[model samples]
Target: MGLVVPFEDKNPDKGASIESLVSLVSADMERVNAMILSRTGSDVTMIPEVANHLISSGGKRLRPMLTLAMANLAGYHGDGHVKLAASVEFMHTATLLHDDVVDESDMRRGRIAARIRWGNQASVLVGDFLLGQAFKMMVEVGSLRALDILSSAAAVIAEGEVMQLAAAKNTETNEDEYLAVIRGKTAELFAAACEVGPVIAGRPKAEQAACRSYGMNLGIAFQLIDDALDYGGTSANLGKNVGDDFREGKITLPVVLSFRRGNDDERAFWRRALEENEASDSDLETAIAIMHRHRALEHTIERARHYGAIARDALELFPKSAIKDAMLETVDFCIARAH
Candidate 1:
């Protein structure tokens, strides 16, 4: 019998979206967007061309918006949040460029990846440039604490990338190892993005930690849902080709669970397809079938909800407010995407 996972109807609305958070931070995001466009300019033409191609792509800009909203929640009064938000965005974009190259991916944000449009050499170089610019913005902010948090996050994210590279194509990867990878790569940045807001706003350390907790948990939930979506979501909803992770031999949480629970024949199939990268054209369908047989996708989403609940509670440190509510709703929005 297949695993029967019961999903809670925690978020009954089902229409939860990032619109609340977007509207809450609209004015500041405009400034962040302006700074992003201005900083992308360079004497070298290709630099701007390549950077703009991805930057202009329709990303939700959720990280920077989180920075802005957190700053506002902390009752910030100046332009430093804008700079920090832009810096956060640059760091994220740089990672995307580098990741596409590392993953040898063709599509990103519904368009050809920068690595494919430009050469790998150009893509890597431009990613370095963006990192340089991101650091420059952090320095301009002149907050040693904020700088330390973001810079440390950068290092952690790099480590996470390396960890992921090591785990790639290894079907034996366990859930704990996978969690460590995403916490380093994805959750650290989210934590930094929100924590910096309170740091710059001169909020209490407790508040800063709370924001970090919220971001960290939310980031994990977000990535978990993405992992589940890899096999279940459409190309349009995923913003990349469906089954991209499968094709890349990425051992995400769904694959991890399915591998552990599957029978001997299923285990051999996983080794052949993921460990050896010998997946045929119909193999993606077969993989999805195995995932369904084990209820891997449902279980992954349940794990996401587990983290999402923590994220929602993390914000309990703050009083009720529009921004807080929006942030809480954003967590629901992240998890609801799977449906």
Candidate 2:
């Protein structure tokens, strides 16, 4: 349960390209930090440690930045971007808090996961607090439509989580079921982040729809790449152990693919793992071999590339701002992470 992400130079194609996006989003994130920190000055002393653990854990803050970038590209000019951006971050953080508990994981980007440090109860309570904070910030945005999109996304994310719990260790889970889980867990919020800019900035319906589609596809691509990485990536490079999903009996792409490729004996092994008890490392190793034989990892990567291309194409509607360029580069950046 206790493993930390490696601290080293991963260098996911680090040039000077994303500096502008980072620069633009950092102020809003700082504002959020201040808002979060002020509670420490109030009576909630424990709030500081839990909140600080998340903040200092060194996440990319990608979701919130996407919201802000979409706002910029869509010609937004107000504090609503800040509020919505913070809202996106809080929602993302809440998911992480919950995810750690669900996975029984004790490490995130080289730090003890919150659930490990403070216990599952603390993690769940903190997650609920952040969810409330996210909604409160959304209300502060003063846009009911924005609120609707985010709330819907949050609901879908929760549903996806439950679906995964049900799907895990179930050999019957197919590509579509797996895709549904990915869409709910990842794409829905991404769509909201991308869609909010157009909504707040008063973009046309078509434009908003385009942004939503673009984000949805991009999020799927990102997760597919993440799934691919789990099979082929080094634990040191990935910030978590390779094949950890298999170890935990997660119904991931590779595992599903391996099951499909398995013969009668192989199917029997998987059935034992799912129906009997947890799988052993040898079971995991053999499963990886079967998946490799069936090229599941490769298939997932190809799909990721397809979605990355789609995400880039969605940007074609824009007339090309620096923000747009950065956004396009980000799509490329996401795809490149797996390479």
Best-fitting candidate, scored by lDDT: 1
Instruction: Give one digit per residue, the lDDT tens place, for model 2 in 199-240.
Output: 999999988988888899889998987887776666555566
Off by over 4 Å in 2: 1-20, 23-29, 32-42
lDDT of 1 at 79: 93
Model 1 Cα lDDT, one tens digit per residue, 1-339: 111222333545379998989998998898899999999999999999999999999999999999999999899999999999999999999999999999999999999999898889988999999999999999999999999999999999999999999999999999999999999999999999999999998999899999999999999999998998888887877889888899899999999999999999999999999889899868988998898889898889999999999999999999999999999999999999887
**Alpha-carbon RMSD of each model:** 3.1, 3.8
Q: After the best TM-score superposition of candidate 2, give how far the Cα of residue 189 lies from its true spot, in angstroms.
A: 1.0
Give me the overall lDDT of model 1.
Answer: 0.92
Clashing pairs in 1: none
For model 1, state the Cα shift of residue 268 in Å.
Answer: 0.4
